[model samples]
Target: MEVRMLPEPHTVESYRRSVLGLVTALPAETVGLAEGLGRTTAEAVTAAFAVPRFDNAAMDGYAVRAADLEGASPESPAVLVRLEPSRAGSPQPRPLRTGEARPVMTGAPLPPGADLVVPVERTTSGRFDDGATVALWRDAKPHIRNRGEDIAEGAPIVRRGVVLGPRDLGLLAATGHTVVRVHRAPRVALVVTGDELFSDAGPRAGIPDSNSVYLRAAVTALGGDVVSVQLVRDDEDALRRVLDSAARKADLIVSTGGVGPGTHDLAGRLAAASPDGTLARVAMRPGRPQAHGRWRGTPWLALPGTPAAAFVSFEAFVRPVLARLAGALTGGEPASETVSVGWPGRAGAVRFVPLAVEADADAIAVHPLGSPDHASHSLSAMFRAPLIAMVGAETANVETGQLVPVFEPA
Candidate 1:
């Protein structure tokens, strides 16, 4: 096997922009409101009915006319007759008559002809009872929650590109929406390459294929689904076959391993052969060798075989692409915090060092979890790390107590 030549390294920003530019969101799909949580809205969802649906009481109190309680106070309370009680989800009570008050539980529909709610505590009827007449100590204004107050009918409750959450699901369901139209999660094919990789509990000769575990979790956490995960030998024929099938079935193809310059690195050879492929060395530590190409109109990305390198590369490149394909707004940079840290740095390449973050009352301190080179290959350390500090390429050395931007993993 001949050594594959790597194209000159591209700046991380430029490379990310290039790769992400080629990918787009998948087709939209309608799913039940329960299943729509964490999915991006394909279009604006308008409320069919008001959020509350009907006017209801905002508190547990007596639903009465504000005029009936006028001039009522603790020293001189207004005596009013009590009507049938109303509780949440129960039938609406009868309208309040002159000199009458109706006991209402929290969230009960406010009856017509009633505009105020005198809290039970403010009246001589300390709590609900068969009291003939209760004394209203203080004049209470209407505590009724009006219809369309939370959400107006036909108003947009959720906008496009917004990811649904727990509260979002409730709002949609409350607004009489049984189903929601959301951007379908992009189907990703994991074309992991390694002849010695095994899925068994333990590998006799080769290392266990562990990248798939984290990669799969990462994909699902980012709102994408892994359509298939295929492990192939370090041979051109086997890799090409998997890539071909994955390209046809998946929206994105991600391959790990077989991108190096070794004799068995056929992934690089195949990627280099593609018409639009660019096998470039990225200007970064740990994850430098990478390949990007198009196979049968499907975009393919290849990362180095090492677990640490693959994960770091995934965070640096694949994350934003997945976000874009999931219809998430991918404009701004990653959310980062400035923390005090001192670690090794590379002068010519950007460094991503995982840090165990600790926050004081007003200051955040970050410490390197393991070797800054990530060569230790400690999976536990990676899991424990909450932040990855991005030291710029020009940064030669990170001094103690210096503030550095760090990113938390998803």
Candidate 2:
């Protein structure tokens, strides 16, 4: 038997870049505004019409010409004939003739020839409807919301590559967009390999499978569609069959377990056999071993079997790649935060520590939830963490109040 040499380990940043390079943006698909939340815009969406489509009242008041209210005061008020009331969504009322006032509700279209609105609070009759002769206490400034004041017609409403949120969808809807064009959600297939996970002998015999649950929820939260989730034993043939099937059905295949350099590590063995595959260690704690490459023209990322490692691996590598494939602008970098407590770091490897973040008006401080060693199997500790602090390899120890790069889990 010939001996095989392992490839040199890659820096955490470099490995992430390599993984991202494996896939491209998916094609665009049209979706209704109601279904556009969390989807990435395929192209810049321009406003079909101006916001506040017509000149309208900004508040509930009487619409009248500014000249008509001139010299009006509380002691000696100007009395005008009240015309028909204008409520929002109602047809436009007759124009405001000189010395004529119209009761206009908030958002109601301003009648032509009206230049200002006197709030009801300023008039003797504070109510919306009371007497035909309305007395204005003082001259009021124009309170009309002009058409296109909030958003211009044909102007960009949402830029391309932006992930649509509730506010974004609302903006689009307000701008006369019933439907939006967004990138197709990437379809992912998960393959979990481990005989222990499916043992019928109960918890005493083997541990319950948490990777599948975590991965499924994470993928969906990030706008990925999980097409299939398969659980297979440690058998090589079984794993291969599942993988081949997954590749045919999914845009990306994510496999957990069987990625280490062990005899039962079928995922690593198969990756080594592929022409474009790479099986290398990254200079990061918890999730250092990574196998990524294309299989059957579809991208495949093999993560470690340890639950914590798998979780961290997905966050550091898969999340960004999935976002990119969905046509979202790449999040440039993990934000920096100050660690509230000190934590141990690996000598030559970057440490990823699960942390619970506390935010106050002044600043955000992070506290570690896992062990100082950043063990790969500490899934329970990581469950309580909302953030992952990236400690540099050069730093053997992280001092309290030290600033470190942090990633928010999806």
Candidate 3:
């Protein structure tokens, strides 16, 4: 019998740098506001016109000249003749002379020469009607939203590298933007290896391949397009064919399973045979066996076959690369939240644990969901967790109530 040994595992940071170094932002494309949700801006979006576009009333009120309502109060009111009501989208009413008032609905353009607005509630009339005159108890307070108050004309509404959200879209639309230039989602090719992994099979038969389902959703959430998903049955030729075909259609390639030193583990072997591929053990439990290289100029990443390992590796390593390719401003770090540890665990190497976080009094408490060991780890329980707790590689043990880093799956 012959024995084979792999080299020392690369540090997590070193592996991440290697993977991110090979990725670049995808090309920019124009997308309408409806389609730009969660897309990263390729350039700063400048406002074509100021928010509000013109001075407008902020509430349903009476637009009046402040000079006309001097000394007006609940005890003694000011009587002013009302002109036509000024509704939104109607042309701005003609300039108001002294002793004149106009019913201004919320968002209605302030009539010219009207310096202030008194809420209809504060006036004798609770609602605006075609009234001949109205009595105002409180003096006008000028409840007007001025032009450019929220955003200035020609000013940047959204900066480059920003991910567009619902509020961002609303602001852009308010600033008169119909379409925006955004970095296109990077197309990803998923290659799953191993003959035993099946998508539909009883537990007694073989393990279910749930990686594809979660990986596809994760890729889409991270702003990457899954162009191809290939399952190879521990065959060198099949892996090669899929890689070759995937390279032609994808910007990046991700393979799950068959990365170990076993004879049936053909994924690592095929990748090592590539023109620019190398197999290395990363310094992390569960996901230490990793393969990286370029297949037809597209970056390829291989993760451990286990569901827990694949999920953790995607969050720690693959997700940052996707963010880079998608033009998100992650700075090589996954989105994280501070959490207090509730249990102790082994932490010689960087460890990732699916965690369920809860609010405990004034602090956030995190409970590790399942075992860290690859075989005993629970995939079903992990799905219920909202966060992944990352134990530092140098920290030997996690102390109770100690603050730790928790990451939300993108």
Among these predictions, the greatest TM-score belongs to 2
| Worst lDDT 10-window in candidate 2 | 1-10
Q: What TM-score would candidate 1 get against the native?
A: 0.90
Better of 1 and 2 by TM-score: 2
Cα shift from native, residue 10, model 2 (Å): 0.8
Predicted structure with the largest lDDT when compared to the true one: 2
Tell me the spans in candidate 3 whose CA falls farther than 4 Å from its real position.
1-6, 71-76, 122-131, 137-140, 201-204, 331-347, 359-364, 372-376
Question: Residue pairs in steric clash, candidate 3?
Answer: none
Q: Give the runs in model 1 whose Cα sits over 4 Å from its true position.
A: 1-7, 92-94, 359-364, 373-380
Across 1-410, the per-residue lDDT of candidate 2 in tens digits comes to: 11132578889889888888888999999999888888999999899989889999988889988888778788878899988888999898878899999999999999999988888887886777667789885443678899999899999878999999999998998888899999999999998888878624455768778889899999999999999999899897888789889999999999888777777777866765665677888988888888887778889998988888998899888998899999988755789888889976657888878888778999776788868574576777777688778888888989998988988888
Q: Give the alpha carbon lDDT tens digit for every residue of 1-410 in model 3.
A: 12232477788888888888888888899999999998999999899999879999998888998889889887788999988888899887899899988988889999889889899988865677676898885543579999889888999879999988999999899899999999998899999988888876555677778888889989988778999887778877878899999999999999999778898887776666565677878778658888777888888888888887888888878888888888987744545554455555565678777777788679666667666454126776567778776777887666666666777775
Q: Cα lDDT for residue 9, model 2?
A: 83
